[model samples]
Target: MIEEFVREKILNTYAKRTTKSKELWEAARKVIPGGAGSGFRYYEPYPIFLKRGSGSRVWDVDGNEYLDYCMSFGALIAGHAHPKIVEAVKEQLEKGSMYGIPHEKTAEYVKELLRRFTAMDMFRLTNSGTEGTMHALRLARAHTGKDKIVKIEGCYHGAHDYLLVSVFPPLSKAGPRWAPTLYVHGEGIPLLTVKNTLVAPYNDVEAMETLFRKHEGEIAALIMEPVPMNMGLVLPKQGYLKDIRKLTEEYNILLIFDEVKTGIRIAPGGACEYYGVDPDIVVLGKAIAGGFSAGAFGGKEDIFSNIYPLGHAVHAGTYNANPVAVTAGLTCLKHVMTTHAQSQMNDLGEDLASGVKAAVEDTGFEAQVPHIGPSGTVYFTDVEVVDYRTASTYDKKKNWEFWFSLLNHGVLTPPGLLEGGEQWLVSAAHQKETIEKALVITESALREIK
Candidate 1:
């Protein structure tokens, strides 16, 4: 009955407000494989084709406006089509978009990044987070001369084969809580790739230590998201990160912090600074380019000295440091994303989390909102989600109803909770009034769900 009611509401609302989006999806499917550019963009029934976005709002093809909390999967920390980013891109457009040659803005941007993230002594740019993690892994392997790598279960580094294992494995196939089997996330990933990559439970230091000892000298590095955003923003329990740092050092293994999601959004220095633990290498992306396509891997001088043209671990890309992206990034870092702005966003996020929790309690729903900085996840379960296994146990059906309810009520969230739980992002443009309105909508949605 609940599913029926939710489906009816969604279908009716979608039909009334997204007729043009439906037509666009039909046309898009003729050319685009899934009627969308990315797999995650597609949802059941159809996705509402976006027309434009500005500040904290977006309009669909059929002219339906929504308070966008997805925020391009937490990439647009400065919010959609921010004026500073727009002006920077416009200025760069007159000069050039891409210059297969080195540009001064690239140097300036790197300097700015280094200034913000003091732990990184040297860095290199990539077109995407995948490239950054790929290069970081290669550098780690080259530096340690080890073939194996350990990654926390449920942490998504990217779509690369090396990090794809055990991302969202079924519990039946997933081994033990402590020792998880390296189950490949998708097909076409070779068995050999799975063999070289090891899995460790998130927030489990003893399990990590055991795994490290088991792998011994063969392991190259242990890469992880310090905050584990992919698993619905799971935080590092008290000493989890510190323990991991100590274990890596004791085992003579390198530590790589995949800050692709947390970087620049959580803090200027990212989780490294927020948690006060610096890894040997860090991979960053998303807001780093001010909503443009960009990624970067940086670390101590000794570690980066092993990269191409310096020590031989080749990392090459044609569009690594495009002028437009560099300009936008520089502008965002220098003018827009100041310490004050970040603090404001963090406070807004906390407020939203508290509001959602209150709504859930008032509505008498079995849910929990776990948040950090400007990002959070709504777990439709009573249990606390500390790791992937707990995250997976969430009531996905109820969660979907909650998501559709929000959509029907003119709020935009991720369509589905992939490996991670249902995530919501708060941007700098999200004001107190906007948050209050969203809370009202959330309470209404929770009431309907109940």
Candidate 2:
């Protein structure tokens, strides 16, 4: 890959700087498999340990500063350590951190979410997007009394047993170009589980209609990302989301919008607001708590009531509403609401996409930055990606070349060039000046890539 060849030369220039980061990795490897908390962090070189973040920057343990477009993989919209959020965290800490029962902050946080999604009658808080998607799927199955699910190919909801199928299937072994074989994204996710997942290409409503007919009563829910950003920021074609919502209602299959990445990043109401499609269930995470590890699922309250104690689906957590997260989330959501932050972030997103496209085309290379809401990516080819088949067809050699060149220029993108292309997130903190600087860096880097 491009990183290996570059590592030989790049490491020579930054040898000593990488040493301390290497040492941290060595120590971490003893306790954490992959030397990182999340498997996503296992990159070419050991990942850098972050010491702090403020605004649109992160300071590594080796004291290297970078313009962090990673944004905790699109988690931190308010940026690191916004003073208002810090004050809320401090105040909440003084009142005691973790209480086993419901707290006042939970009500306040829910209210903020309710304001954005007035259609939701109730919601349940969770610790991460993974849990949110997992539980949402469970609730979906319970409500509809079905055993299978339908998801757009290459779309990711979370790392659950059922949803973890076909996220990154190998193109060579993947059956037909149109009907790729269902393979689990990770090991130990049962083949039976994989069998239960119906794969349909994104933006293909006719294909989805065919699947709806094939497995009519077996499908519990149709879960997917509103923008399918994980497959490299492909926006839904006009009427795509609306068609799915309509079909799911017709078939009695629950419609779950996995807005974990798109939620609050697209708008206060998320992709639902952006596309004007109201799903029965919406799974939110990432930016939901302004970069903190927080997640939630809100729907028609009757569906949520299917969970145990009140219903049959079982979900529990030690830190479901831990004060630190709740306080951070409350502050972040409140700020997003007041500032009309999604509009600001969307403006930045458009500028970033436009500037990057202008820069890349000037290099005479077929590259473009595609975006929706506050997030997007620089695909190294001009191909309009809509589904996994198209995304896999892009020239990956040029893509990774651009990736490493950008890294050398001091811009940290998403870990691994594995997502077909890396995603770039625009934060409320990344003002006009920041976008311009990144554009300049992008232009110079594009020249270096070819």
Give the TM-score of each candidate.
Answer: 0.97, 0.95
lDDT score for candidate 1 against the true structure: 0.86
lDDT of 2 by residue, 172-271 (tens): 7667755657777867876876677888778887778888898878999989997887777777777888988898888888888988888888788888
| Candidate 1: clashing pairs of residues | none
lDDT of each: 0.86, 0.79
State the lDDT at 247 in candidate 1.
95
Worst lDDT run of 10 residues, candidate 2, spans 4-13
lDDT measured at residue 251 in model 2 versus the true structure, 0 to 100: 85
- Model 1: per-residue Cα lDDT over 1-450, one tens digit each: 334435676667767888898899999999998799987788767789998999999998788889999988878888999998998899889988889998888888999889878888988999889999999999999998998999999888888888988877899999998999888987998898778898999989999989888888999999999988776778778898998999999999999999998889888899888888989999999889888888999999988889878899999988899898888888888888888998999999999999988988888888768888888878877888889888887877777777878888889987764324447888988999999999999998888767
Best by lDDT: 1
Error of 2 at 302 (Å): 2.4
Q: Which stretches of model 1 miss by more than 4 angstroms?
A: 1-6, 417-422
Q: In model 2, which runs have C-alpha deviations exceeding 4 angstroms?
A: 1-17, 417-421
